[model samples]
Target: MVSTTFEDLNNSKKKLITDALLNEFSHHTLSTAQVSRIVKESGIARGAFYKYFDNLTDAYNYLYHFALQDIHQTITTDYHKKFQPDDYVDQVREFTEKSTNSRYFELVKMHLLFNEAHFSTPVSNHLIIENEFYWATQVLIHDAIKQLMLDPSSKELILQKLANVLHRLAKEDD
Candidate 1:
């Protein structure tokens, strides 16, 4: 968690630090990121960096959640409602397109490629409900995203496979 001191910063100052963290994480894995670089880029003192975050991992978590919130807002599907395989595929496709073009592209790519498994807080498995089908679909969706990050040209094929599996799961549940 970030310090209250960081939360107290004005929006513009927060954005500056956010941008710097994004740039640093986009270019380097968490293992290689440098506080000095972030401080220099954000125009904050090294001491202020520590004051704002407990450590580099805290800063990275902050940036990760920040990007996630922005991306989630762009997705229109309500997963809490009925799970529509086609609709989910469409949503994933839209997300892939937007994320590829967004400012956080490299950061997301870097995370999927290298840093994701190393996160201090492992990715959540919590779902809206506790059905095994829902859990499987969620895992598959995440895998599809990772696959898209690795080979963007395979998107149509990947989405098709994902849709096929999801439809099969839905049918089985009936």
Candidate 2:
């Protein structure tokens, strides 16, 4: 997480650093990311980067949180509503397929790749999802997205299966 100092920065200055972080993380995996590049691109001093975050991973995780917030803002689901299966499926497709080409997509891919190695994981980040039905749906959608990444031809089939799976979940509660 970024320090309050970062939060205190002027909006334009903050955007400069955020843009630099985005460009670096979106282009390189965590293993290859360098703070030197971020500082250079943002035109901030090397010491300033450390003042904002603990390290590269800290900054990367902060940006990940920021991106997830952005994703949630665009989500169309009203989970408390009468469980419209179509709405759920569309949300899945948007979060998965449509986001594959997003600027933050590569950074997300890197997180997916290295998520397990973070020894001191937060509760939400842990794999022990207590919501069984929600977990099941997410797992199915995530698997579908993984397959879509390998083969775009699976989109139609994936969409059908996504709807079927969500519909099943919705029906189960009735």
Candidate 3:
């Protein structure tokens, strides 16, 4: 989350900073990114950047959450609703199809595979095990999609294999 100073910025100013951050992170992974570059590109002073976020990780998390918000809006997932394996697969498939169309999809996948320190830790108050199961499945889907991207020729075969594996996994819940 951005600091109150950032949230309070006028819409145009906010949009400028957001666009600059998105472009910066889109082109470079966290380990290779530089705040000085972002500040120079955004035409803002280094102090302004710090005023909005604690550090690069904080800025990255804010942008990452922004991407997730877009994804959730594109595909509705009710956390409170009962879980069904088939429905879960369908939702993942839908997200996979739609998400690939976005410009930030590549960056999002890179963040997933490369950023080990940022995984969400589920709260323990309710359905903690269920949350872990879903999180694991999400990770599997990300890895499968990334693999498919790397070998476009094997996409159909790999997708079929994944479906078969998921089918077997779903049956275990019976």
Candidate 4:
């Protein structure tokens, strides 16, 4: 979580810090990130970095969530309502296209490639045991995104494979 002091900063100052953090995290994993670099890039004192975040992880989480929100806004599907496999695929496609083209691309790629596994906290998997279909869909969608990141040229093929599996699962659920 960001500190109140960070939230209180003016828009320009906030952008400077956040943009600096984004650039740092995008190029390096959490373990390798340096506050010295962030402060230098943002033109802030080293002490100010501590004032804005509890630590490096907090800063990373803040930036990650901010990127998520920005990407989510580009999705056209209404997640609040129930959706079909096609709708889910459309959402995934939109997310892939938008994130790949956005400033957060490297940040997102680094998260998927390295940062997620390094974090001590595990991603929630209760849904796997509770709803197999939904869990499978989530897995397929995530893997597709991973594939896209690894081999962007295979986006269509990967998405098609995911769609095929999801469609089969949806049919079985009937």
- For TM-score, the strongest prediction is 4
**Deviation (Å) of 153 in candidate 2:** 5.2
Assess the local accuracy of residue 119 in candidate 2 as a C-alpha lDDT between 0 and 100.
34
User: Which residue window of length 10 is worst by lDDT in model 3?
Assistant: 119-128
Of 1 and 4, the candidate ahead on TM-score is 4
Residues 1-174 of candidate 2: C-alpha lDDT, one tens digit per residue: 799999999999998999899889878777789999999999999999999999998998888788767766778644346657787777767776555766667666666665425634553354354466765765676677666655567777888988888889968867
For each candidate, how many residue pairs have backbone atoms clashing (under 3 Å)?
Answer: 0, 0, 0, 0
Q: What would the TM-scores of all predictions be? A: 0.90, 0.77, 0.79, 0.91
Model 1 agreement with the true structure over 1-174: per-residue lDDT tens digits: 899999999999999999999999999999999999999999999999999999999999999888977877868845578878998898888888878878988998999899988853433545545588887888899899989977999999999999999999888767
lDDT (10s digit) by residue, model 3, range 39-158: 988889999999999999889888877876776675766765654556655666666555566766766666756763555545322334565555555556656766754455776676
Residue 69 lDDT (model 2): 70
Q: Per-model C-alpha lDDT, please?
A: 0.88, 0.75, 0.71, 0.87
Residue lDDT tens for model 4, 1-174: 799999999999999999999999999999999999999999999999999998899999999989989998867644335539888888888998989999999999999999987554333454446467777777788889988987899988888988899999989867
Candidate 2: 10-residue stretch with minimal lDDT: 119-128
Question: TM-score of predicted model 3?
Answer: 0.79
Candidate 4 ranges beyond 4 A from true positions:
76-83, 119-126
Q: 174, model 3: CA deviation in Å?
A: 1.1
